[model samples]
Target: MKRKHPELYEILVKTYQQDISESFKVDFKALMGKLKERVGRNSPCPCASGKKFKKCCLRK
Candidate 1:
């Protein structure tokens, strides 16, 4: 089917890829937010930096 309709196949592939990427971005952000909430402001940064969460990546 795809070989018989290369243009349609390409369009479908591009649309599906875009939709998957957008969904992943949303899920990743939500996951990060949950993880961030689990870490305390005064806790050491997850990156192993001696700095506190509030002073490190949290500031970003």
Candidate 2:
């Protein structure tokens, strides 16, 4: 929810869109999965670093 962290989520969502692209026009679950696998790594706080949710910040 960018409403909470407008600045951070704004950048994050932007980065997410750049990486996802138009091909991500699939289901919500699948899209979310890809997003986590892509930008949810380095982001330890929100774990949205373009990496797999399991292997992302979720681990550490």
Candidate 3:
């Protein structure tokens, strides 16, 4: 999988790490806004595509 979308994955993973590491900051509005722009939105699907959260593998 490293051969596919390496740069995007790298940046996204790093951003997520940063996000999780800041869990106790008492404020997440700003951080969440930025993450939303970068990662898009997430919604549940009943089709059971069994993919990662942001992948939308269940969209089909």
Candidate 4:
């Protein structure tokens, strides 16, 4: 979806961030940091696309 529709993907991501922040009172940056710690840049992406995180979703 992201590759085919980058603008829509960004909008959805922003909306999701807002929803998470409002509903859980969570800090999105901090949450992303924790997630980044768990996934090495050279490791396979959590999205299961068989590509390294840095070359895949991390590009976003």
lDDT of 3 by residue, 1-60 (tens): 557989988988888777564565433344334443343236432223454435643232
On TM-score, the leading prediction is 1
Worst 10 residues of 3 by lDDT: 39-48
TM value for model 2: 0.27
Candidate 4 structure quality by residue, lDDT tens digits, 1-60: 999999999999988777454565545345456674577799887666698888876755
Model 4 gets an lDDT of 0.72
Question: Model 1: per-residue lDDT, tens digit, 4-45?
Answer: 999999998888777565454334344446674578899886
Supply candidate 3's per-residue lDDT for 60.
26
Q: Rate the local accuracy (lDDT) of all candidates.
A: 0.70, 0.55, 0.49, 0.72
* Per-residue lDDT of model 2, residues 5-46, tens digit only: 899998887787785557654454544555544543344433
Instruction: Give the CA lDDT, 0 to 100, for residue 32 in model 1.
Output: 47
**What TM-scores do the predictions have?**
0.38, 0.27, 0.28, 0.37
Candidates in descending lDDT order: 4, 1, 2, 3
TM-score comparison, 2 vs 4, better candidate: 4
Q: What is candidate 3's local distance difference test score?
A: 0.49
Root-mean-square deviation of every model? 6.2, 15.7, 15.9, 14.1
